[model samples]
Every structure is written in C-alpha cells, then in structure tokens.
Target: MDHIFSPWRYAYVTSRKGDDGCVLCGIGAAAPSSDEESLVVARGDQAFVVLNLYPYNSGHLMVVPYRHASHLGDLDAAVLAEMGRLAARAEAVLVEVYRPDGVNLGMNLGKAAGAGIEDHLHLHVVPRWIADTNFMTVAGETRVLPEGLRETWRKLRGRF
Candidate 1:
C-alpha cells in the first residue's frame, strides 16, 4: 500500500456544493436552445441525456428524467420507461461516435451510494476502452480523458 496524490481534487473534495435544489431540475428547466450550455446531448419528452461534468471517460453520459425524483421507486412508469429508452439511445450514440471497447451503465441511488446529486436520480453511461484505466489511475489516482465535454456533446448531439 503506497500513497497516491491528486492535489487537483482538493478543491472538489472540500468545496463541493450540496444538493440543495436538484441539478437535474436546473438542466431540465433550461430552454432547449441552451442545451449546449447544459451539456445535453439528447432531449426526450420525459427524459434527457447530458454529459457528466465529472466524467469517468471521454464520453461519459447520464440519462435523467425531467421529473426530479430521488429514488427509482419515486419515478412513474412513463418516466422510468423513458429513462431506460434514453439510456439505451445514449449507449448507442456513444458506440457509434466513440467506438469504445465496452460501456458501463448504472445508477447511484443515494449520497452514500456515490450520487453527487443524490436528490435527482440519474443513470450513468460510461464508455470504457481496453486500456482506459492505466497507470495514471492505478499509480496516480487520476483519470485522463482525451476529449472535452463540449466536444463530446457536439459529436453526440446530432446523432440523437
């Protein structure tokens, strides 16, 4: 066991904002014309797909329902169904645009479960390559994403 440092994360760890009013709610409330500013790649009637501000990989995305719900059980059937559909669409878009070796899809239900915005439930779609997790992560505890979020948004937005 050795020590690895990521001093860049100090500000994030200490200054992280609390989930007061849901971030998803703010994104959902944003006008469609401002989708790019919100990092939204796709917009559906019930749900939408946006890039994760803190991404695991270049094409990391989240499928979130417009309805601000904390838990899966809190969402209605329509929202739940649309969330699944949007997640699938997001994966498809990522595959076509990124061509990653694999994809990870999941949901963190609460703060203790690693949900940054625990008040608004969202599904994560992270793209994974064969060697995506390399020495940087193992030795340095850092992730290197080759692409920027705005660029990723541009690549996937039209595909949706």
Candidate 2:
C-alpha cells in the first residue's frame, strides 16, 4: 500500500481538539510581519485574503472580514463590498498563477450549511481544473497537492 504523508496537517489535527477560537479572526488579527506565516497574501481596508490552510486545490484562498461576523447580514455594506473586490482579485491572481479552467467563489453560512467555522463568515475562492478530483479523494479519502503551502504562498504573495 502507498502512504500519503502530510506532516503539516499533524499540527492542525492535534490542536483542533483544544482550539476554540475563530481561525479567521486570529489570522485577521495577526501582525503584518507574520503575514507570510499566516499565508495572508493581501489586505483591503475591510477585508483580507489568506490562503486556505487546507485547500481544495492550489491557490485556494479565503476573503475574511476583520470583524468577527457569523452571517452576511451581520456585516456592513463596506465590508461586503471589500470582500467581493478581494474575491475578484483572488480569482485574477489564481488565473495568473495556476491558470485553472475555472474559479469557484462561495460562502457556507452555518454548520448545517457545511461551514467548518460557523461563527465567523468567510468567502472561499478556489481554482478548479479539469480532472482535478481523482480516486485518491474518493477511495483513499486523501488529497494530492502538487505544491507545498509555503511554495504556494510564495507564488501568490507577490501578485496580491
């Protein structure tokens, strides 16, 4: 049997049990000096772009508001507008960096709606390509990524 090793995920898997804070809010509040470590590529006045810790594909990112808000209606117009603008920018950056066939932008509002973080809202920007999904994800329940997170962050950080 072939084994897929993702050592980086160990930290998340181990720490998740004890973690009660909102991940998005923590990233949003992090200092600019730690942006690279946090995988934050860009920041707008009301929102910021950070790479998804676990991505569906390469260049998967999230646009999150600075304020902690669980629902769309909880945010003001300015925050919503900036998140949209940032999501658009993320799409452009993904196209330039990965050149995927298409892009997906979405928001999952609550636990019942498939939100991993139900208390803080975020917009997911994913880059999709032909045949990106494969048997490993279906049968083995594992994801195969071509590049490492730091490498992905390096490739995308400059463009944003």
Candidate 3:
C-alpha cells in the first residue's frame, strides 16, 4: 500500500493565482500580522511577518515586502532595511518562544533557485536547534514536528 500521510498538520494556502496579481501586493500594508486564517506574525509599514502555513519548523515564517518584486536585486533599499528589522524581530520572538539553538534565514529566488513560490520574493526565517532533524527525514521520509502549528502560532503571536 502506497499511502501518503502527514499527521498533525494544518495548512493555509497562501495563494494559487500569480498570473496578474502579486502575492505581496494583495496582502496590503495595514493587514493584521496574524489572522486566524492567514497566520501572520507581525505587520510593518513596508513588510509583513507571516508564519509559514506549511513549515519546516513550527515557528517558520516569511518576512514579505509590501511591493511585488520578482528578484532580490529589484527590492527597494527601504524594504531591504525593513526586512532586516523584521528578521531581528523574528529572531527575538523565536528566542522568547522556542529558544532554538540557531536559525536559518534565506530567500530562494526564482524556480531554478528552489523557490517554490518564485513570483513572490520573500525572506524565510526558520528556527533551528541541535537534534531537531531526526531519523524521520533521514530514513523515514517524514518530519516530526515537536509542536502543532496552532500552538506555535499562539505562543509566537503573543510576542508581537
């Protein structure tokens, strides 16, 4: 029997349309950082912090700019600075909540660069720790998340 099962999961599809609309543009500048549906962490004037609805780690989040830019080089300087600020805030929140030993901050540009959603340029902040990766990934082809998304969102949302 070849059955795929992802236990203990909750996901919010960020978007399915990218033909004419920009993922960053639709979310807006004044939207709540985390809505029950959207799972946003914090919102800034030029940036938005959102929990990765489908995450590598429970607290995984993306800091997205308000403007829609396909490439990293196209980002405005102000948005870049704001991204840094949001990154710092994300680190602080993760420390306060998960207290992970480390974190991974990155942006995968374009489809060739491993960007699953290439049209939306966003920075990913994934919390990490020693032994966080287990046999599930190495041998079982699965991941064991220590906490659920809702619990993580509750803990993280309180910080901001």
Q: What's each prediction's TM-score?
A: 0.83, 0.84, 0.78
lDDT of 2: 0.75
What's the C-alpha lDDT at position 104 in model 2? 80
Candidate achieving the largest lDDT: 2
The digit string of per-residue lDDT tens for model 2 on 89-111 reads: 89999999899999888877766
Clashing pairs in 1: none
Candidate 1, 1-160: lDDT as tens digits: 0111111121232332224455677777778898887888888999999887767778888898888788888888998899888888888888998898998888777655666777787888888788765723532534566777788888888797
* Full-model lDDT for every candidate: 0.74, 0.75, 0.68
Error of 3 at 130 (Å): 1.1
Alpha carbon lDDT at 106, candidate 1: 82
Task: Estimate candidate 1's alpha-carbon lDDT, on a 0 to 1 scale.
Answer: 0.74
State the lDDT at 99 in candidate 3.
83
lDDT per residue (tens digit) for residues 5-24 in model 3: 12212322245323355545
Error of 2 at 158 (Å): 2.3
Global CA lDDT of candidate 3, please?
Answer: 0.68
**Deviation from native of the Cα of residue 42 in model 2, angstroms:** 0.8
The lDDT ranking, best first, is 2, 1, 3
Compare candidates 1 and 2 on lDDT and give the better one: 2
Cα-based RMSD of the predictions, in order? 5.0, 5.6, 5.8
**Which segments of candidate 1 are over 4 A away from where they belong?**
1-20, 135-142
